[model samples]
Target: MLSNFDIPLLLGLAVLATLGMVTMYSAGFDHGSRFVDHGRNMLLAALILFTVAQLPPQRLVQLAVPLYTVGVVLLVATALFGITKKGSTRWLNVGIVIQPSEILKIAMPLMLAWWFQKREGQLRPLDFGVAGALLLIPVGLVMKQPDLGTSLLILSGGLYVIFFAGLSWRIILPVVTLGAAGIGLIVIMGDRLCEPDVDWRVLHDYQKHRVCTLLDPTKDPLGKGFHIIQGMIAIGSGGLSGKGFMQGTQTHLEFIPERTTDFIFAAYSEEFGLAGVLTLIATFTFVLMRGLMIAAEAPSVFSRLLAGSLTLSFFTYAMVNMGMVSGILPVVGIPLPFISYGGTAMVTLGLALGMLMSIARSRRIMQT
Candidate 1:
């Protein structure tokens, strides 16, 4: 078990976790025991990572179907009977409350990788269609719950698996083009489309507001735009060298909202500045590259697909969180990986890295 560890990946994770704790200490010092609880969550995640690294790629493949099945069932159950908080019904009350959508973050990739592995040689367009269907079930359920952030994460995970499993750019490029065109149209027609009486039939009112607000935050600077405006202010105030640790005026003065969770990136930037943000990015890039390397050298198709998807999931999480905090993207409630104080997200990340480690371990055994 000790020998199975990927030292570089472990080191990168250690750095991120340490940063998370240090930042959380300053950011959440006044929020009761949040700093201590963040440390505890990191320990719990480490324990999970260790336990999961012991499992082989073959064992993971075996568990894929059952795990995905259970996840989908739980999503349906949540839809039927779940806890409603902040107008979203995402958590299911089993023995304890659990967000069913979080399960799909890992299970989606696992199931897709398993499917592709089984269909190794006999691939067809129908297979990809089936994969999309599988991906959309939980995604649609989560969307219905109005948890767009989790749904997008889960969707990205499944799509990565599909893309790795021989998806052609021919089928991908048109969708990308269409999405870009839609964004352009929105930018051109922002004022008219964002009017109070105007109805965007596809998106919910809140979702539409997020997009419109992202386009022009000053439309409601103190309302919907407050998060983005303050986040940008903090990031800009940090300049090139930052104000040093525990000295973030915006964070300490409570100007940066959700400083301990979704918006922690803003708080981190205010104290660490561009230089610190670059260091954080470099650390994440190192871990991401290591995960990709593990995938490239994986002993089996399933391991490769699963590892690649899981690795890219980290990319998605970091990019979305950072983008939203920087005001370049809509304010999606995505956490900044290790830097954010969320036990569920942390544990999910640990599980993902452990799977990558399992694949890395298998590759080493085969090489020997």
Candidate 2:
């Protein structure tokens, strides 16, 4: 129940949700019922969190493999027969609309945590190889669906589990070095590599465009670069003091696109400025720290890894969204956690936090 939830975590989430509502109200500009619907989504998400929290961590571990198995099967079905909209075939029409990749975000960590727990102290390099294979399968499917943002989320969540389970640094270091080197090379050869006629074989046309736009948004001001250019302008125009609530000129004038979704942070920044942005960051940080505390107190390896991965996954989600909006990263469809308005993303957040609460509650019970 709600009574079992950690107090500080709850308070921080409450403040963030309230702030989301305020910013959403302004973002909507009374155009539709988005503010009210967002409130409804929050309520529904809370109910899910509370219900899921009632289960013990043991129960969650038990559900892990089966949930993962089923999620992967669904992804396969989605691949064969899925709805295609906006040039991406990510959703499946199984009686209702379903995006299977979202399942892997939670399932990936659950499955990995359980896998490591089963192996326990008998760990070997082969086990890590097997784990990497497991992570890659679902991630590869999601990528084939061409949903870069969700793929990253699943990849990160699974990798976090592998990381927290004491995977060797020798393997981790090389991958990190390669990724950094790849980024540096891209920047160095951006002029030639990012040309209009050039084909970045690894990425789709739109994906390639986003990377180029990130390097220099002004190149295609009225086309692909428009979103990033406008987002930065809105953020910069806000200044330190902001334009006051409902007073963001860029937002009100419709210069900042997608003000209620992926780019909502820019609208919020335009309205509340640097001070408000700092407050949001602080609240998110508090939530992450409290989550880590719970992870540390968990009784079992499965519980600890599951909790820790979920917590850090939230950090990744927020950072990616904020980075994309700020022009530091390519624009993707990742939402800003509680601050972004989306029912599906809200449910994912609720499930993760609810499981964290369940782990924390189990620890408290054990202590007594």
Candidate 3:
């Protein structure tokens, strides 16, 4: 099976996995035991990637519904008895503290794709409405857990499935217009959007703080604004060539919070400079383009939607992390793909890559 796979795509994924391990090592070196844990996670991710790549795309499609159903149940369980940390209930313990929402990041696309496949060539506006509801179920739950970043990522992945399923622009255009107007209204209203004496019914306090911080980081410079301000400083201070690897003052001195996780990009930029940043971005672009090509050639609608959504989700992860680090967006705890140090996220990404490989290989088989 390995011999029959798409060699270029497999090789690209291998290269990325290698890069992830190296970056994790550097990022976790000071945090004693973290480096070892990251190494273990990388190895596990590699194994899962290989295993999933060997599976047929049709088999994956068959498993979609069950996978999604189990994932949604786990998310509901998390909401009920989850471990609360940092004012968010996003993790559940079934011997291990696991984030169930990560599972939905992949599962949502799988289920939507499967649904689309069932209704292929007969899609309607009402079908799309149902799909949107399917997506919102998990998204709403995660948001109530107050894991804004993860919720947005899951929502983005689900939206990708809708887009790839030939969802009409007639329906999409009005939604986009409303979204734009809503954002405009928020900006116009500013702090009043979440006044304490007001209704206080819409957003959680932390979520509201994130938006307020995005609007004006200086407003709470020493408090909630610190992450954004420090992240931007680290990014901008890199200039053209970086301060050199392991020589990042902000990172070394511990000024950058979550240095090995959400804000890893700031540390990376401060160390490797503009050239390194471009190289990383180029690799990500290559992966996404290749994944999309695979989706285009997939043998089934399910494979196509899953592959496309996974690709876009990968892109969103990179973009959101970089945007947050550069101070252009709110400080959401989103890891830079393959570059940040975390076991669960690495495994999730590996699974996504594996599904892409499966889609590509299935297409190759069909061509023969």
Candidate 4:
């Protein structure tokens, strides 16, 4: 049964993993140990992906409730005694310091897919409300933990499940319109909304600063706007063909902070230029399109929801990272999928791809 797994999906993951290793090596430069760590992470991720892919989709659905319950408990634990770093209490020490929210990133989609599977062919407006509640609970908690980026990613993932579960655009359109109006209102009242002493308590200081910076980076050009400014400069300097690999002054001179992490795209662009950027984007697009095709061909509602959500979530990661670096959006710390340096993120992505492969393989078996 396991031998019937989707070769294309596996090949795609292999290609992305290879690209990640090469990019990580370039980003690490003199710190060869970082590259080694990345390799170890990729190996572990591949193992997890292969193991999980062997499980039938029904088993995945069965594990959803337990995974969600445990994830929520861990999130609560994080709130009580989680480690504080850079002014956010988002990590829990359970033999290893892990961010509980990352668990929700996977678990939320699983839980939602399970819910939709149970109510298959009978979904209604109230069902969507329940799903929304499920999504909001974790999102609200993460945002309070001051992790805006992860919270948004989780929200996007769960929403994708809801969307693919046959949500009507009639309902979606109004919500989107209202959300746009709300953002416009906030921007209109930016100064007062961000004042030191006010009753508007919807956002944290750093989060507010990010929005303000996005609105007018020139206001704090040398201080709060430094990251965006430097990132834009690096991207602009890349031109059409770029300066050449390992010859990026902005990256090599260490002018770009977080060059190997959140802002790695800027460093990559500075070195590889527009052509490289297009290639990277195209790779991500291929992965997303393939995942969607897998979702479409899934044998069950659970697999379809899960696979589709994971695909969109991957897109969200890339979009957010590029948007932040280009100064068009807030500086949310979303790493570029399969490119940016991180252990947990890579594992999460691998798990998502594995699910897609499982769905594809299951479809093939059913057709046979």
Candidate 5:
């Protein structure tokens, strides 16, 4: 079991997990037992990672269909009868409250990789279409729940699998171009489009507000824009070296909201400064490169696709969380992988890492 573990990857994870605990200690010291809870969550995630790494890639493939099916069913159930909090119905009471969308973060990649692996030799455009449909069903369901962050993660994970499974640049380039154009248009018409009376039919009113707030947070400094405004301030306040550990005035003074959760990046940035942020990014990059290497060496199609997608999912999580905190993107409530304090997100991340480790172990066993 010890030999099955990937040393370099484990080392990278250990570094990040350690940083998370240290940051949480400072960020949540005032919040009773929050630091303690964060440590407990990390241990749980470690346990999950260890348990999952023992499974073989083939065993994981066997789990894909049933997991995806159950995920979609729970999503549907959440939409129909889930608990509503702060105007979003994203959790269901299945013995205990759970957010079903979290399952798709891992299951989406698993199911897509399994689909492509089944049609390995004689692939067709129709196979991609079927895969897209499978991907969209749960994404659409989660979007209806209005949990944009989780849906985006799920969407990106599935798309990464599709892209790795021979998706042509011909189809990808045009979509990328269109998205870029849309962003440019939004910037050009920011003021007009952000007017209260103008209906952005696709987005909920609050979601629309979040986009407008991202465009210019000062527009409502103490209202809907508070999160972005404060986040940027904390990050900017952390200069070359930082204010020193446990000395973040912005974080301790309560300027940075959600210091232990969604906005932890801002709190982390405030205390650690630009230097610390770079170190954190370098560690994440190391893990990412390591994961991609594992994927490149994977012995099977299912393993390769799964490993690649899950690896990129970490990229998405870090980039999105950091981007939102730094004022470059709309605040979508994504946590910074091991750094942010959240049980569900932590567990989800552990499962992803475990799958990657499992694939890596498989390759080494084959070589032996």
Candidate 6:
């Protein structure tokens, strides 16, 4: 089974996972179980990846619609009968607690790729309109769960598929401009708009607070801003060469929150510094580039769209996590790909890698 796998991509994943274990060990000094749990999740995901890679793209396409439908139905059920924990109705307990929004991350690209493949040659406004409807249904449900990070990922994943299927820049440019304008407006009105008395109509209270905290972490240094401040401090203190492995003071002192999960990048920086950061970035770049080449050479349109979208989805997840930790973006529930210590995310990433493997393997067979 390993013989059929894409060696370069697997090697890149291996390096990232090794980096994750080292950082998790240093960051989880107090909680020994976290290190073990992280390792278990990685191994579990590896097994899943191995099994999934055995299937070809056609079988995956056959599973797409049903999987997407089930995922959305579960999301709706969750809306009606989901368990609320810490004020977020994100988990469903069907004998075991699971987050349904995570399903959308993979399902979005699958469903969209299938939709476009079916309508391959005769795409029109109606087709794009139908695609948008398909995308928004689950994304809207996830946002209703108030899980903004997952919602964003699903939206981006679906959008990537749509874009690959030739969504015109005539429509894309205006949306991009509007997004830029919206960011500018937020920056300009940061002080007044973030006032305690003001109400953000669209965003949840905590979500609004996160944006405000991003703009001015010093305003609530001891409260809402602590995570960003500490993350940046850990990053800055790393300087160039780092403080040495397992000796990150910020991580040891507990200033960096969720050190084995969302903020693991900071802990990594404090120990490995700038050189390690560049190396990690290069490894991810290799994975992304390899994925793009595989997508380009895929034998079918569905395979191409699915593979390309999954690659960009990984990029988006990693970029958002890094940006938030670097204090350039608001804190979201996103975790660094392959480096974050969560079972579900590791599995999702594994499924993605398996899809890439299946796509790349198809190309190799065609050439041979």
As a TM-score, model 5 comes out at 0.99
Report per-prediction Cα RMSD to one decimal: 0.9, 1.0, 1.9, 1.9, 0.7, 0.9
TM-score of each: 0.99, 0.98, 0.94, 0.94, 0.99, 0.98
Worst 10 residues of 3 by lDDT: 193-202
Winning candidate number (lDDT): 5
- Identify the runs in model 5 with alpha carbons over 4 angstroms from their true place: none
Q: Model 6: how far is 196 from its true place, Å?
A: 1.9
Winner on TM-score (4 vs 6): 6
Q: 308-361, model 5: which lDDT tens digit per residue?
A: 999999989999999999999999989998999999999999899999999999
| lDDT for residue 266 in candidate 3, whole number 0-100 | 87
| lDDT against true structure, model 3 | 0.84
lDDT (Cα, tens digit) per residue for candidate 2, span 245-346:
999999989888888989999999999999999999999999999999999889999999999999999999889999999999999999998888899999
Assess each prediction's global lDDT (C-alpha) against the native: 0.93, 0.91, 0.84, 0.86, 0.94, 0.91
Pairs with backbone N, CA or C atoms under 3 Å apart (clashes), candidate 3? none
Q: What lDDT is reached at residue 138 by model 2?
A: 98
Residue-level lDDT of model 6, residues 1-368, one tens digit each, is 46667888888889988988888888886866999999999999888888888888999999899989999999999999999988889999999998888888888999999999999899998999999999999999999988999999999999999999999999999999999999999999999999989999899999999999999999999999999999999999998999999889999988898998999999999888999899889988888898898889889999999999999999898889999999999999999987888989999998988888888877776777
Q: Tens digit of lDDT per residue, candidate 4, span 219-328?
A: 88889898999999999999999888778888888788888889889988887889988888878888788888888888888998999998899889998999999998
| Residue pairs that clash (backbone atoms under 3 angstroms), model 5 | none
Relative to the true structure, candidate 4 reaches a TM of: 0.94
Q: Which is better, 3 or 4, measured by lDDT? A: 4
Alpha-carbon error at 134 in model 2, in Å?
0.9
